[model samples]
Target: MASTTTVPALKADRPLLGIAFMLAAGLLFTLLDTAVKWLTQSYSPVQVVWARYAGHMLVLGGYLLILGWPRCREIMASVESLPGQFVRGLLLLAASTFAFLAFRELPLLQVYVINFSSPLLVTLLAIPLLSERVTAARGIAVAVGFVGVVIAVGPVDWRAQPAALLPFGMALCFALYQLATRRFGRNDHPLASLFYAGLAGALVSSLVVPFFWSPVALGDTPLFLLVGTLGAISQLGLIMAMRCAPASLVSPFLYLQIVWATVSGYLVFGDVPLLETYLGAVLIIGAGIFLATRKR
Candidate 1:
């Protein structure tokens, strides 16, 4: 999904830089997720969603102004792409909400393990939606990836831990979100798409976050604000990473987030992953890398 065709070839000549950017993005994202998980412990998921999107909007808006606001009007013009922005935002909102809900009850490792399947889902969806052909190797990779998901989730009763399903739902929503970005966002300025993503999420979430809003204590204000800041930074890192190197190189590095998530989960929450989680992560991540690196 990160391997969009629209990324300019001229900007992607530095694979090493892209790899570094991707690593940084992954780390920032892991931290952002950890913060969201912690905040969701006290506030509603919708409120956290609001912070994520709202902060993203503020940062991106500032950066756009700093860059001389190139194509500013075209980017803000809603007539051409309002519906696409709405759908993409709603899709991501669902994904983030599900992820936060899952984080409240599940270990970060477990949530990330299931969420990592989004790329695999994207490959499968591309076959039909993008008119792309799936060779046997790619097909096998997708199948093995889902098998790993089952291994990660185990055969536990859903009633006992229904939150376990939330990550899977997040992965699905995020996969569609990626697809929408590729399809509907191919022609727009990348910054515009980023800006609208933040705006759309903020707009939709604004409708609900107010009802669930809890006033932050003065001391905790910075911590709450950090959530959104980290989100914007992570997203900017992802864009820069892609610009620095070809998608194939930069995309696989996204798997590094699982390692960060595992470490962060252990240190912050005292949550240790089961041996099976390791085995499953190995399988899922291996398949995803194989699929990601394979020639399309």
Candidate 2:
């Protein structure tokens, strides 16, 4: 009886660990974005993105090596799902590239606010792409979430600044990337997707990075490397988090990233979002949370 009781307690602990991982991942991702923004000031966003992917690959490769040759071979031998993995990687690359380009022009807080809409997009896309059934409440939640996005965009005419739409585009790409992940999850180990995500971006970027690469200042090389290292760590954190807890329970924790982004943007970039952005964020976040918790 005591052992059974202890088992339930141990099972309950998993979600807590998952939430902790999600929080850590959020902060790490925010730091990666901060570094990317800093890098973009001196290098092209393309070059910065390449560094992000290359660095991710380097770190992931080191881990696979440490896991021993058999583990490495197992990861490499998984070929049936490569196409899906490759596409997911491409979508993430596109998403990150779009956001980075917008980062060069927009405030970090605004970029985050727009990007966080991915949860809503995911909720909506699941209905059509995955054939998941969505009840009326989720439909309303989705609509309200977009209204939040509009508010986050502020009162200015959106057409006046085409660049403002970039983060939304990023959100769309990311949502699709996630959908692909869900599709691939049925047949592949999560590690396989991670390997392919890093591999896809690293290989494709290698071709173009040369054309865009500028010599880094000697002092900044560490920071450049740091960007990729943090990205890899954050991605690992996300995987661990999912393994630790239910996806529905842990996912809502991701919105915590906007809090980090807002604080970091203010301190690092001196960005102060207008009231509209804040209100929109609240709505989007509220709707997202509701969707995350509502019966799936």
Q: Residue 284: error of model 2 in Å?
A: 1.5
Residue-wise C-alpha lDDT for candidate 2, range 123-157, written one tens digit per residue:
66666665656789878977897888888777656
User: TM-scores for all candidates?
Assistant: 0.85, 0.87
Q: Residue 263 of model 1: what lDDT?
A: 91
- lDDT tens readout by residue for model 1, 62-108: 88787675467756663346777667778878888899888888888
Candidate 2 ranges with C-alpha deviation above 4 Å: 1-21, 78-80, 157-160, 239-252
Q: Pick the candidate with the highest lDDT.
A: 2
Q: Name the lDDT of candidate 2.
A: 0.76
lDDT, residue 94, candidate 1: 89
Worst 10 residues of 2 by lDDT: 1-10
Return the clash pairs for model 1, or none.
none
